[model samples]
Target chain A: SAVISQKPSRDICQRGTSLTIQCQVDSQVTMMFWYRQQPGQSLTLIATANQGSEATYESGFVIDKFPISRPNLTFSTLTVSNMSPEDSSIYLCSVSQRADPTGELFFGEGSRLTVL
Target chain B: QQQVKQSPQSLIVQKGGISIINCAYENTAFDYFPWYQQFPGKGPALLIAIRPDVSEKKEGRFTISFNKSAKQFSLHIMDSQPGDSATYFCAAAPSGGYNKLIFGAGTRLAVHP
Candidate 1:
């Protein structure tokens, strides 16, 4: 399984400001997933970042609000643009291990963002 | 509408008791079901997972009971202890579609010592 290190583990931003979160995997992977967990809420899929391609965003999310960058297979970044209090949540980055071959994925420690 | 639905927003159990959380999915294409456990301020970690081919899977203190016919799956924690107190989430992913998971609202479990 790949070990993921996420930066800006926690952040506090003012309304209308933006913050960028980065995730680095120990090993190369094809698909890197980004998730958001609001306080006392379920984890929501933000997008799937494929290296060398535009990210596929889930319904209710868009590239303009949550811009993602997948420079390579092992790393990706998710930026929250024009932040608001509703955007405060715990952001997670995850990748599946090819060894399992079962589609089971592993996740990073998560970056908790709080928009004031 | 939520693709996956979960029951009992919260649960409480005593030591050596059994803790169960149930989830139902509306998508029949989902082939993978996984359960995740999250501690305070930590990311959710995979607990156990099951495929449609199997009805049950167990790993140590955790177990996944899957019902393909009903499109429902559950996680059972045996010998529930205070250490097991945390939030558990049930998620499902289809064969394709980038394997993006659809997660349940999550169930907060509190095990008394």
Candidate 2:
């Protein structure tokens, strides 16, 4: 099990501004993920943060908009660029063990962003 | 593609009663299923999980009843307390995949005293 601590638990930003959310894990994990939970909606995978490589994003998500940085096995950052009203949501970072066959994810507290 | 679906957008149960939340998935490749619990303004934590090999698994006050044939699973909280109120989400992922998860629409459960 890993404990993830995310910074800037919440923020209210103006449009066109960019914000970077950080995630730090207690233990080294093989995979780290950034997910967005829109208001009253299910969680959507924004990207898979791979160490030393470009993050693989979902179809609707792009690196230009949601850039990711995975410097090591225990840390990663996600940047929300050119924020808009639609980007207001709770962003969560998740980590998982490599040896476990089950896709059990340990999540961070979350970063609540309000774009005005 | 969103592979998982959840029902009963909201539920209200009295204290000392059983609270059940159900979820269904359309992907047959998903072999591992897990449920997460989240309070307001907090991140979700892993609550309980089940593999399709068994019909049901219980831990403490939480029980996971899984049906492989129907591709459905449920979380049953026994003797639910008011503190147990939160949003419950069910997730599924393939065993050999990249560990990416597909989550379902959450169920908001409220336990009234």
Worst lDDT window (10 residues) for model 2 chain A?
A: A97-106
TM-scores of the models, in the given order?
0.93, 0.94
CAPRI docking class of candidate 2: medium
- Angstrom error of the Cα, residue A115, model 1: value is 1.1
> What would the per-residue lDDT of candidate 1 be over residues B50-106, giving only the tens digit for each residue?
888999999999999999888899999999999999999998887754247889999
Q: How many clashing residue pairs appear in each of the predictions shown?
A: 0, 0
TM-score of chain B of each: 0.95, 0.95
How does model 2 score on DockQ? Answer: 0.62
